[model samples]
Target: MAARQGRFGAQPPRSAAPGRRCVMVTANVDIPALKARHPLVNVIEASGVKLRGRGRVRQGVCPFHEESEGSFTAYGDSQRWYCFGCGLGGDVLDFVQQLEGFTLPEAIARLEGGHRPVPVAAPRPAGTRRPKSAALPPRDPALLTAAARFYA
Candidate 1:
């Protein structure tokens, strides 16, 4: 089968706005890789929020709102956070974006350090991608049980 050309009788001239070049810009940033590389808990903690509690989850005073008790929980393993007090929950990117009020590109650039450009993750020639551990260790049930009883 042959491709059909448009009303110009052949392929239309590739043109962009008068002064600007028709450059191809891709928005395919490796977000998953970025999130894994930049831990949410570390970022939040670095911002001077005191994370208290134990296990994969930690609670900190909600910076978005005024509260006596801490209601912000940062999940160490997931690199995600949630503010039960205000009901805001999302991934590392979302958290940074919201906190910093930065656009997607700006947030990515900030996370990546404006030194180098971000490259898209190309599809592998081999089989599908395999999930890797985020360096989170397995939880010990016995320890958790002991802690629960102790806290109770």
Candidate 2:
């Protein structure tokens, strides 16, 4: 079967590298502004995901992360999203990135309906993780495992 087309209307290019490709698109399209144009209720309805509450905001299952309880919140006023369970929070672009696994530019293009293609970055070789900051400690595998189980 063909891979599904993402929210951006295009699938991730087979030749595109994970990190090198243009993660985001043109800066003129402000994610916040696009988000503002659509109410949270409308977006939620468009997504076809049932929400628990009726109003400007609603809580529902996070499409990005696994959770038994509804910890994802969509805010109509700010056009932003927050997941207390996963600690992943950001504007609509971020939400699309997390939920649909689209690059920043792809997400923007999908949401804004633009045809301009963003440059794709060269792929990095296998087994290389993003460079870590010296100020941050290495992640604890045990902690991550526990969190994964908790979410599951």
- Report lDDT per candidate: 0.70, 0.63
Task: Give one digit per residue, the lDDT tens place, for model 1 in 109-141.
Answer: 777885322222343344333244255778999
- Give the poorly placed runs of model 2, Cα more than 4 Å off: 1-24, 30-32, 114-152
Q: Pick the candidate with the highest lDDT.
A: 1
Candidates' TM-scores?
A: 0.55, 0.53
In model 2, what is the error at residue 28, expressed in angstroms?
3.8
Q: Write the per-residue lDDT of candidate 2 for residues 68-102, one digit (tens) a residue.
A: 67788877666777878888878766765665677
TM-score of model number 1: 0.55
The residue ranges of model 1 lying beyond 4 angstroms of the native Cα positions read: 1-28, 114-152
- Which run of 10 residues does model 1 get worst, by summed lDDT? 115-124
